[model samples]
Target: MVARRRRGAADADQYKPEAHSSDGAVVYVRVQEDGEFVITDDDGQPYDETELRVLRKYAGEGMRDMLQQACDRLNADLSALATVHCDTLSPRDKPAFQSRAFPEPEPQRNPLLQPTLWSRIWPPARRRLEEQNERRAEQYTRAFSEWEEAARAFNEQERQRREQETELVLTNLDAMANILEEHLGEIPWPRETSVSFDLGDDASTIAIDIELPEEDAFPDVEYTLAAKQPKVSVKKIAATRRRMLYRDYAHGVAMRVLGEIYHRLPTVQVALISAYVPTLDTGTGQPTENYLYSVLVTKSQWREINFKALANIEPPATLERFELRRKMTKTGVFKAIEPFDVEALANEVGI
Candidate 1:
């Protein structure tokens, strides 16, 4: 029977004509002009059945491991779309500062206090004890003064840092953008993605634009091992199922962005977020971007969502609760639409 070659085993001499016997013996079978099968090695000698069986067993095991790894990778990519969470920030609490403690000097004992009565009564010993005690006291005072100066300087520096952090959380637009970038950058996306942020004249409103991955970026096939042979079967993903996955991934990204903004920027009242993909314009025949969806999420409505139950929530259904603009077909295919203008939309909606 004909069998496919194992993946990554590219040595032509090793797998000339792929075949395996009923008892799991690895044999290279060639067809003659008379339609008869001949099992032979690279030098055309008859293959030893004992060696063939051993090779077949190990090849089967390797194929099973490879198949398992491929399945796990696909599952991880799919799960990444639905799992997004972040720690929230609070501006009311003061940043914690670690203060340095004062260093205490060890107590010194007078060497003149010997067990002998003469040594204790000696006048020179008494004078030496006094001098030693005075020097120890002076050294301790100097150390204490230095420690006080250092503590004051450290406290002042920490105070300025805390003030800067509080200001950024309250009203600094540039600082807010930087912080947002850092938070968003930390997300482990399945594909390459880029994002940009804009702050409106009103400090509480913000806009976000995301460059989504193209449709071709997703995996379009699944791998499985053959039941009887050490071979892999690659099956194409159905068109409808792929479309649904794309829609879910896109919506999931949108939901994650909204969640991060509300959690990280405590003062943001409204967010205008849009996602788009790079494409060639039909009319101009030039490279351009197509906006897939745009949404306006308000902080008040977002608060009602149960963040703890995010795993059970479907991203596309969750987005239906907001003011959204999208042109998706019944089969989950998206069409281009114009993105929202941050200030104008806010003023029109009285948000």
Candidate 2:
């Protein structure tokens, strides 16, 4: 057998979006562009642009993939939960009723032993044996009846439990969220993070808010040898290069989300995903935000595109079928887009 190697911390730390969770807790979403797509958490803090660099580091993957994974985990957990305790009922002790006849007093045993001690003893002893047998037969009959009753109750409980589980799967949104939370809770992270989901009417449409790390998290740096000495320094990246990377990352996140959602919830044709970055508005000392990326797409239209064929697709490329609103300036700042119209998207997808 080949030896298996253990994974290192760096390898284990590869970006994994938090599993989709539906606890009522707020989910803060910060996009990298302008302040267009910001969802405040329970803290009621406003968006801050200066903090954007920090917020981009821990951004999670789209909810669709997370949810799909959660569903798989839930199915496994439910399968385990669905198992009923087996009732190992031993077979009841059945009495074999055979004909038992008493000897006729042994014919006075050699006639000379008339009125001997054993003659009196044998008659009484036989009577006692007959009585003991009757008692035991009654006891066995009651034990069998008790065993049958227990078996019936066990079966009835198991049937009801199965029906309840089926209903939970069909209609319990809370249960789904809880399962997602449980699944996500297993991932490793340096800090505590939470996931929350919003469902449109009839689960037909969905929106997700994922908190992400700041811009500083992605360092543009390299290790080098200068003057025969090893050194590390920051690498200056071009605006276009950085822009492309940011856009690609955002798009990748969206595609991952959309793809996973389509896989598990094909019925939900419309989806809106927004990434938010926290930063401080240089002018105001308070925190602000940039809309890193957002996309609205329908499964019906997206279903046709072979995502794997294209080497690279930006966020705008996916919005060809519908309307989009975003602000971009020459200074490398991106403004947020207008609020997405779920109803319009839902209708467009013919949901």
Candidate 3:
């Protein structure tokens, strides 16, 4: 076996990129412009990184080929070592290692002395051997643990890099799609250019249609920005996430002021949703019995809509008592909602 390995080493020293892991595993990767080879040694050990010096006087092969050769040589070396050490080892007089599992030692012992002598020494010998073996095993275990942790961290870094790449690709795709849509709009649809929008209830689609009078209008129309601007983002995740641990959605605080009113408001559609309610979902646990409502609207654009004369939008579902505040005063208050809010009120009134 040793002779065979010697031949293998002679054959391997011919190649370039060569490195070995701590466990003696050889590694071969593409050779960089520099003689250094980049590799991972079992875990995150940077021993295999680029710019590593090659001690051997390599000759007669390309960098890649040489590195591969080195790996083969390393593996061969390790195999030889493994063979000589604790494995199906070569003949050695391991006096302390006398065991039925292994062949008899070279210097034969007296069969009678083996019994009495073994009986006397075996107990202490066995204890010492066991302790040594356990320590060795522990050392081996720690080595593997360190290797595993390093490898896991390395793999995670690679994963994050991949995700970033994927995100970049997706963003580029969206940009390209927008460009294409704008170009397509210039082709002129069979129908005239037109536009319509409607917001409806749950399970309802917001229908939007744009009409073009002629193909020429398509070139004049800036559709790309308009198309991309309408995107709605939705996020779905596990409800049991850490941040949601203390969450509680208030189910009932029934109340409704059918005709709440803010007189001559700036045409900005506003709803006075006053209620004595349980605290906000998470940590804030105050009851609404003592909170004021009338907050300004944000996150949406609406024309100057006076709450006065704006029709009260009764929820399609039942309202809890806490949400029900003083009834909106002024019967005229039922007519001042913004166009969109009016549309909503129309639906509510119809319901």
lDDT of each: 0.63, 0.42, 0.27
lDDT of 2 by residue, 1-351 (tens): 111111111111212224223443343433222212343444647536544333332323333333333333323312221111111111111211122233222222121213446545798765565566666666666766666676666667556444433334234444333333433344332222223345544445666544444434332322222332212222455656555444444444445445544443424457676656667888987896566555676666666665555344443455444444456543335666555555655665554
Ranked candidates, highest lDDT first: 1, 2, 3
Instruction: Estimate, for each residue in 1-351, the C-alpha lDDT of model 3 and write its tens digit.
Output: 000000011122333354554444554443232223444333435432132343122321333454545434433422322121111111111111111221222232222212245545779766666666677667666766766676666667556444433332233333222222332233322223222222223111121212212112111111111122211222232323211211110101111111101111111132323222223334566432222121222112112222232223222112222222232222211111211322432343211
The clash count for each model shown is 0, 49, 41
User: By lDDT, is 1 or 3 better?
Assistant: 1
Which of the predicted structures, 1 or 2, would earn the higher TM-score when compared with the native? Answer: 1
Best by TM-score: 1
Better of 2 and 3 by TM-score: 2
RMSD of 2: 25.2
TM value for model 1:
0.60
Question: Could you tell me the lDDT of residue 225 within candidate 3?
Answer: 11
Worst 10 residues of 3 by lDDT: 1-10
Give the best candidate by lDDT.
1
Candidate 1: C-alpha lDDT: 0.63
Q: For residues 150-264, what per-residue lDDT tens digits would candidate 1 score against the true structure?
A: 7777767657545544566567766566556656777666667677777665557778888888877766765554676544455687888777777877887777777767766
- Candidate scoring better on lDDT of 1 and 2: 1
